[model samples]
Target: MCFEKCARCIGIALIPLAVLSVVADILLYFPNGETKYAEKDQLTTLVWFFEGIVGAGILMILPIVVFIGLKDNDCCGCCGNQDCGKSCAMLASVLVALIGMAGAGYCFIVSALGLSQGPYCLTELGWQYPFNSTNGRYLTNYTSWSECTEPKHVVTWNTTLFSILLVVSGVEIILCFVQLISGLVGGIVESCCHCQEIVRCNDIEVNVYEVQE
Candidate 1:
């Protein structure tokens, strides 16, 4: 039951994080709230990969649903036995949590790469990644951000949204890992308890038969 409570809490927490990731990824397409950059294909290539939209947002839905469902004891009505059903549900939750972790991990990696490579924007020379070769040093060096002349503060916009995705994905990964552990332990414990119940029932039946004889 504690595991179920934890799963429910995690599920609720993931909802807002997923929504935030999707919003951040969408924002990357339009720098400075202008669609001109997107029309000119000046957005970062990493944004096109949809790590935040697909990986962190959509991919997390299934796991969230599963985790939320874990809170309801009556929902696990498999094989005409509540204990067996609960065991099955907990094991299934472990698998769902793994899927969630994979999605969040993908988003985290892509966000990091996006931040390191910097955003694609138009400069005096033309559109390109101005800080691509900076090896992420530009993050701390405010002077380098001026390299991207167009899209007005694109460097700042990209950094803000990408940073948000990075942090949100990291938290998601941690929550999923915690849920995975909880589900695995809960499953094992429920299975052991279910087995003991069967043994006890069988012993009672045998003793009754012997007394009747």
Candidate 2:
């Protein structure tokens, strides 16, 4: 029951994280509040991957639903046994948590790569990756961000949004792993309790028969 509560809390927490990931990914397409770069196909390639949207956002929905549903008392009514039904639900939750973790991991990886590679923007020469050669040193060197003359501070935009995705996705992965462990523990505990209840019932039935005899 405690683990079920934990799962519900985790599910609630994931909602905001998923929304933030989608919002951040959407913002990546428009640098400095301008859409011209996206229109001209000058946005960073990583944005096109939809890592935040598909990986961290949509992919997490199923797990969230399962986790939240764990709180329902009659979720397993179709199984005809409450304890057995709960065990099945917990097992399902464990599997769904793995899927959520995978999605968050994908988003985290892509966000890191996007940060390291820097954004694609227009410079004096032409449209290209000016900071790609700097080995991510451009992140700390504020003066170097001036290289991307177009998109009006694209480096900062990419850095902010990608960093957000990185942190958010990392948290999501951790939460998913926690849910997975909790689900496993809950299922095992429920099964053990169910077995003990069955044993008690059988013992009671035998005692009554012996007294009647």
Candidate 3:
């Protein structure tokens, strides 16, 4: 029930989504290995990198679906006959979109949680673990969050990358859902219309034969 134009438009829109996720992942690379045990262990950067790849891969389905649809020039003419290629293509697209949605959704949730948790650290001030402050005098063999440099604890790069990952993947999830629905509904509608046309044609042929007899 959806026209080629509609599918094409959706496919075109998918390009940007893929690009955005890819870009976010590229940015995530900078902070991925920066997790130092002496500080907090922020896995946001690592998670973002992998999820961005998954999200980008999912977005690729739209373009492939569009390409297949375009290549099947006889789809409309052979409407009455089932075109396995078209059906398969649509099914494949739907499956890919579903996978993409799951991946993006996961990344979104993990990133959100990581953001809230503010990284994992046994103690906020590991750097100051060697010293303790008592009676206005600094003593050795003590560690506390109070002694750590506040600014050093903040992983600026990871925070920014994770924020970007969270936003881009969220957008991708919505797009994947839309793509799945459109492909499924459109393919079914087209198949039904083809069947109806074939029946109508058959009825016309039968009536003509009876009149001739």
What are the C-alpha RMSDs, in order, of all predicted structures? 1.4, 1.3, 8.6
- Across 5-43, the per-residue lDDT of candidate 3 in tens digits comes to 555665666667667766666555434444353245333
lDDT-sorted candidate list, best first = 1, 2, 3
Clashes (backbone N, CA, C under 3 Å), per candidate, total 0, 0, 1
Model 1, residue 9: displacement in angstroms?
Answer: 0.8
lDDT of 1 by residue, 6-119 (tens): 999999999999999999999999887898878878788898989999999999999999999886753346768888888889889999999999999999999999999998
- Give the candidate order by descending TM-score: 2, 1, 3
Which model is ahead, 1 or 2, in terms of lDDT?
1
TM-score of each: 0.95, 0.96, 0.64
Query: If candidate 1 were superposed on the true structure by all CA atoms, what would the RMSD be?
Result: 1.4
State the local distance difference test value for candidate 3.
Answer: 0.55
TM-score of 3: 0.64
Judging by TM-score, tell me the better candidate of 1 and 3.
Answer: 1
Give lDDT for model 2: 0.91
lDDT of 2 by residue, 19-103 (tens): 9999999999988778777888889888999999999999999988888878784455536998877877887788999999999
- Model 2 bad stretches (over 4 Å): 73-75
